[model samples]
Target: MTDPQVEPAPTRALPLVIAPPRGRQKPPRHLADLSAEERAAAAAELGEPAFRVKQVAHHYFGRLERDPANMTDLPAKNRDAIASALLPKLLDPVRTMEADQGTTRKTLWRLFDGALVESVLMRYPERATICVSSQAGCAMACPFCATGQGGLQRNMSTAEIIDQVVDGASAMANGLVPGGPGRLSNVVFMGMGEPMANYKAVIGAIRRMVAPAPDGLGMSARNITLSTVGLVPRIKQLTDEGIPVTLAVSLHAPDDELRDELVPINTHFKVAETVEAAWEYAKKSKRRVSIEYAMMRDINDQAWRADLLGDVLNAYGDWNWVHVNLIPLNPTDSGPMLNGQVFTRSRSDDMREFVRRLEAKGISTTIRDTRGDEINAACGQLAATE
Candidate 1:
């Protein structure tokens, strides 16, 4: 595959906010935010018996019930009080749009502070997956991403993050989605914000997700996929955390020169360094790291670039440690920051050639299925409009 004679797009300067701004009011506390010991202490503080908290946990985490009115086993008099203190609503659904005959639902949620975020629930024959947001908006300033176009509002609390999953689970269990009563089988942190940026809260949410049914969701860590835009330090930290969640690095470009413009954070952490961290993570966790490359018409979709990407990943030895997932660029109207540039999805032939180049180097690759296109299923599109 020869390099095509295509002129590179001119780079433009955009403001980037790597760190979230300070002094934003935190979201209300919820039971999902606390440990078992903390929940019992909270129950005692609320003038309820310790066992009451356990029962509530069973309802929330086990039964996927959020309304105090539905908790019939608890004493009716204390249900409201206990619910008010521990199960305060974190996400208020502003709007829900469905696609694929209602099997895919994208929800726009407003937090307590009125900051907007979005999540998506998709059902398949074999499994159900929910893509949850970790923050209100994004700070990465990835030029083509809708979430990054709107700067970071604030970091979401752990409970706020967990509520998205819980709500999705409730929807599935209640048969609200197209499939009749089913359980959520997987979760992906690929919506709205960078999961690694909100490290503490994201980790807390994962802990609650993998804990036992009475205390947490009891979902397998392998079922959760955490995506990052190559935050090297956080990737290393996650590798050391001993949690075996799948890691996905949003590596839009194989070279630092292009990545610096596509992903502003690349200016600090080069492509080699970021890939190294992901490689190290795969080695330690014994889990394959997914290389997420968004195919943009001619910008980063050249056949030569695909070969370069293969070389880059194979440099660390092709022990099946990495797999490439090519995402078709979702359509978004060009905003001011884009300098009147519109990124189009790659042509099917070009994409095929790109895949061929990678496969030639023995790199495992798969093209991601783009779902809910009519509902603007891509992260931050609905929230940004709202």
Candidate 2:
């Protein structure tokens, strides 16, 4: 088959190397970064009317439809063309595993490029949430995470990220779908890649998600979250964007020495500075910042460390904005602490007692619920070793 023509992606001119590696790596390109104008141009070239671009946008971004047969607004002649133009089969279900009484679903998508990525659709009585990935393989080598162990294959484009949510949203709305028809209430970038690593595409995808129907995906800005392993500079950048979405900092440890090995980037910006920066975002955005701390047994979970965490947070008590999600570590095949995260001694009893200490210190705290444990739900785990 002749190579199909598609719109050329905008060039960053800045090369894709995060750290100058010994060898070459391909420049990252994912389809989510394109603006509506670019998508319209692409559609026009495919003989789709310029207006149908809006319809396609409505379907993918607004209506969140994948099946062309369901796109009733277009002429039957154009449905196939429009569908082929924008919603090219980015991900087809390789498999879906459900647990938590069918309320939680984990889907492994085989991308058109043959890359695999995972998204989770979890349901609660109040709202359903979709945890989506912006990259196929993560560049960050956070040891505890299954995805990090694999190293970075590449960043997923904007469409790749948005598609995961759109599909989930559609499933909820269509009722004929997998997780049942209900609008998605939350979208989180706590998946595979360091979202900041795929910065532009990730931001573009966010705009698409929150933009109104016929313009973008039409989900509320408040329902989105972009978690990072404390990328200090990007955290500042996200604050400047003023999107009002939640900012989650994966600060696995409150101290730098461990984070340097656990999160790596923290070596450049230590825990204190990262928390300060997060305070800045919270102050400006007026939204609470979430500190994602994965509690490893005998690791960072000690009562003293938790007390120190409270001390650090208390330093910035002015913002009225911060919470800790102490995630209990999920054991992996690698030796413990190879990820350089999860302290060597969490003293579960002490750690649980410590949350009381932090709260006594007036720091907001909660232990996060673990999901998708049965089906290797950890990011990059399924794609790893494949």
Candidate 3:
């Protein structure tokens, strides 16, 4: 007898390309890509003093100023040369769209090589958050994702990634977004790509984000969240890296058979190994790992699956080391459809029941607030289409 509550898994199969294409044009070098010492050396190579590098760093990191014309502290003769050398223009704003009564702003940027990526700044009453992309498009090829549908163009350089946050910070500092000029308090690696695949650049960007001002953005490491589709090796590497940023595992389904279809990476790293790796990360980092589950109607949103998920997470001795963030499926019109069936968001009653089942197992759970759906700026919808 078939279980009426569970829908049959999609018949479609997606090709898994673990490696990004080779020989793509590299992003231009900017100061954000280098360490403080490296930046000083580069400045000296340009015939400028080390303090000139510090002045430019202060303007870029402390005052949120990027324009050389506004950096009056530098001598007029050397200003443009230093700025041109260290702070090459990385992200050119192509178009920006606003939502949520002008509180949510999404900017589409054109990289120097013409690769398009997106960043979103969302303002709440107390704090603002920016979701930045780590790569131009994605190679993960998860069938339900819009960016995955487009495939990967290239991994963004560290400076390219940091520039998005800098742009958002500048906007907030200048009173561009609503809520009267607030500071950007949080950043999430959830915009357009699977961050773990672009590990080097992503970690570099994170280092720049948490370092003290005049050297980097000086944001708290705790305020940054990096999401991955259960990249086990990368998760273990992050555990040993000593930086304590929160880790989010996008485990859409609890069982191997279902998760293999939902998150294609599961075929290589099964559910048990993935969840255990996440648990180890939590134990080491002392930061709770987030389990991100996108609720799709009749696909992975069954109450029984929620119970299974809670059990899987609790197997590591349930020391409150994990939290389940149930995400409402933000459907994309351009996403791949299987057998003429478009993936849809779970119903309200089903979502409520899913929450109840997880909480019953002593697992903390919350439904993520869906935002910017009207303008296609929500989760899983950022493709940066021209």
Candidate 4:
């Protein structure tokens, strides 16, 4: 079959070497950032009745309402003031592009300080999932990721992270997309940042997502998945938090030699140590850990590598406690440029063989369906360009 005719993604010239951002803009306080007690205290500080906090929380989290006018539970005079103070605008939509008949939407957001981040909302027949960023850029300088090329600007506040979910939920609730009014079912921290790097704020955001309404969005903890690039210590810390959100480790390569080049942090935490940490989390949390491997043609997609990956994972735990998600790498700016990124995508047969090899080893694996590639849907591509 011939490939569909589509325009090539415009390359935005960027520094090959990533650099730390010099300055950042501070976003205003958001209600999601506060605890139940903190929200009430904040309301009191604004000279509003304590009950006002619940009313606002109900509007934002419960009803997916963000506009002050829709928050009629609060007095007309105080609604605007309270909403403005507690729920200040944190993410400004710079651009929105939709694919898959408008069921898949990718949004480019500009934070208060002019820093750029991207999120994706994908609606299916049975579920709607949103991928949100936890940081402005990214600190993990993975050579094959657009965000890694940009480097870290700053860590996003809890409210900023939660606000992305609220936006996705709001979009689903209002029938703005192809699917009529729906509820967001899944949230993934698989966008620009390394979620574990922003540990505290990301945890706070997760709490706000799973906490009962008036405190959080009230989504099931199981529906949330946090992806990390093998942050060994942080993974152990998360096990103690008692939140059962699925942990996804981006283990691009199974061996230290390749992993050190693919995921630079491997230099600090070797592959064996990282997988061991994930196994510990799975043992304690009783949740199946997801191992994410992005398949690149001839780079890490060799059949022997697949067997090695299975052996490495098998050494830690059984199949029930772990699963592998093999992603056919998207053509991004950071992808190999010798003959353009066309060579970056692993062939279907190669991916299938890779999955078969893993499953044959009594390990479970699945190939991830690529989405939004036409619009440069891979994390930082839009932000880096637009």
Candidate 5:
């Protein structure tokens, strides 16, 4: 059963910790960051009735209304004051690019402080999905990502993160997009930063996305996915949150040697530890953890590597709940470096062979469709570049 011609896989040793950037920048306060009681108290302090808080919440969350003038149910004179006191403009669209017959639109947003973050909305026959950024840029120095090249700017506030979704929903509601009026059915936190790194705001955004009308967008929790580059402690903490949103682990390699180089953070928490954390999340949430593997040329695309990966995942013994999503690395704006290159797209034959090897071992696998490639909207391509 052994392929003697192929070289043996290298031994994966636990790597030493590579310290991450210290001192995170805090974002400004917004209404979405407040709890329900706090919102009511704020309204009361503003001389508006306590019931007005729920009314305004309905306008923003349930109705997807952004303009204060459009809330005709409120007093015309008091509408602006109430909205100004509670809701503040967060994201201003700088540029929006459309591709794939205009079904995929990517927006470059300028925050209040002029920091840029990007979000993409794609429409399908039955569903429309919006990819929202949790931070202005990324702290994870994944060599293949354009976002990581610039380093982290700061973590986005709860309202800033939720505004991306509200904007997409508003676009769909007003028929601004090509595919007629439709609701946003899915939200994925895979745009610019690692969701797990911005734990508080990201969790708050999830709660708002899942809570019913007037309190949240009322989207189903199951439709939202939070991806991380394997932050072990946060992965365990998320299990107790009880939201049950799908957790996607960006595990590019099964072995630690290559992973430590590609995902520098891996040096801190090795491959086995990361996988175990993911399994714990799966057990608590009862949601299958998606293993995201980006295929590159001869680097990590060998058939033998696929077998090794399968063996690693099989070690967890929950073969039924874990799925492998193979992503063909998108060519980033950043060129190849001695450490690694973002432009190294894997060959088709090698990718197929890798998938075949995994399937042969009884592990479920799928190749992700690289949507919005023309507009640089694929995975790891959100660098806020024009």
Candidate 6:
């Protein structure tokens, strides 16, 4: 009798191509997003125990990348297969750049596909935060940000996005980061792309973030913030997701004229309309909406514009529903090589006084301490260097 031959089981391969029209073809669904039952079904497909799905999740979530071998929990063969299905190829750190007294570290990761996306790990005395990228490159052409300047290459798979967090969490848990073994308490989708544009996967990553370990990563929703440059309808959509993450709107200007230029999307959805939608989201989410104002010199940085900003926000019915994050313009590579940002032209302190005008009117305000400027890691600055 001739020896019988067996074929190798199929594995997942992400199609690397220019993403087709978003509606024409569905983006490749990742196994990370599936429910427990679905994960069991996937485990069963690999000729492994359905229960091993939970064990694999424990490897990723409960232990925070504690080696499956270290689990001492699952049978050898099953642990290997389970780890392969979920983590697959992990992101190895290619470069680590730090600034702000080692409190902020921006890691450039090479995915299995070799696509370069950056994530930032920032430390505050009370909390450690991770800023994650939702897409590889951004399509939003915000002239000030390097990532936006690169243009959109592709959206990250859910696993690809979530893994950045898992990797960061693991790094923190293992004392690999500056402060040893501190918990990662905050997640921000403000690093690379317009997160709301990659709606589905971002939502999936959020669900995975808050779910209890073994079933999910178990991070709190309050510690996570999903930022967007005023994508009106999507802001409306997030209200239904029922997660109470604070929403940060990148409203770079108070009026349509400058905003139309600074934030191009303003041309499509006017400032008034955007804030109204933000208001709806605030009411539904029952959380304060964050308005991100990028201060540029002699460009939307006028005292009149400040007063107008306060008035416009006041028109939203109550100033208490909104707060503004004033990001002083970080220098970009376009100006000079080493000292890239042209801060000589603008003083952010002047803008701080403008924010004071809003605070004078009974509105809440916070001047975000600038971090990671030395590494070209500030918001929108990543794609610039890439």
Name the best candidate (by TM-score).
Answer: 1
Tell how far residue 273 is off in model 1, in angstroms.
0.5
Per-residue CA lDDT of model 3 for 5-116, tens digit only, reads 0112223454677677899778777988887679878987988888888888889989888899999988998889889988999999888888888988888888998888
Per-residue lDDT value at 103 in model 2: 72
State in Å the error of residue 136, model 3: 0.6
lDDT by residue (tens digit), candidate 1, 76-103? 8887988889999888989999988998
Q: What lDDT score is found at residue 127 in candidate 1?
A: 93
Model 6 misplacement above 4 A? 1-31, 333-345, 379-386
lDDT of 1 at 263: 88
In model 3, the number of clashes is: 0
Candidate with the larger TM-score of 1 and 3: 1
Residue 137 error for model 2, in Å? 1.4
**Candidate 2: Cα lDDT at 224:** 87
lDDT of 6: 0.72
Better of 1 and 6 by lDDT: 1
By lDDT, the best candidate is 1
Better of 1 and 4 by TM-score: 1
Task: Please give, for residues 1-386, the per-residue lDDT of candidate 6 as tens digits.
Answer: 00000001112122222232353333333456677778878877878777677777777787876465676677776666666665576466778887777777788876665567888888778888898988877676665555665577678877778888987888778777776788888998887778988898899999999999877789999889899988888999998889999898988788898787666788789999999998888888889988877666666678888888888888876537998877666644334121232322247677777778878877777666676656767543443445
Q: Clashing residue pairs, candidate 5?
A: none
Each model's lDDT comes to 0.85, 0.71, 0.83, 0.83, 0.79, 0.72
Span of 10 residues, lowest total lDDT, candidate 4 = 1-10
Compose the digit string of candidate 4's lDDT tens values, residues 200-307. 899999999999987888999999999998889999999999999999999989989888867788888999999999999999999999998888887789899999
Clashing residue pairs found in predicted model 4: none
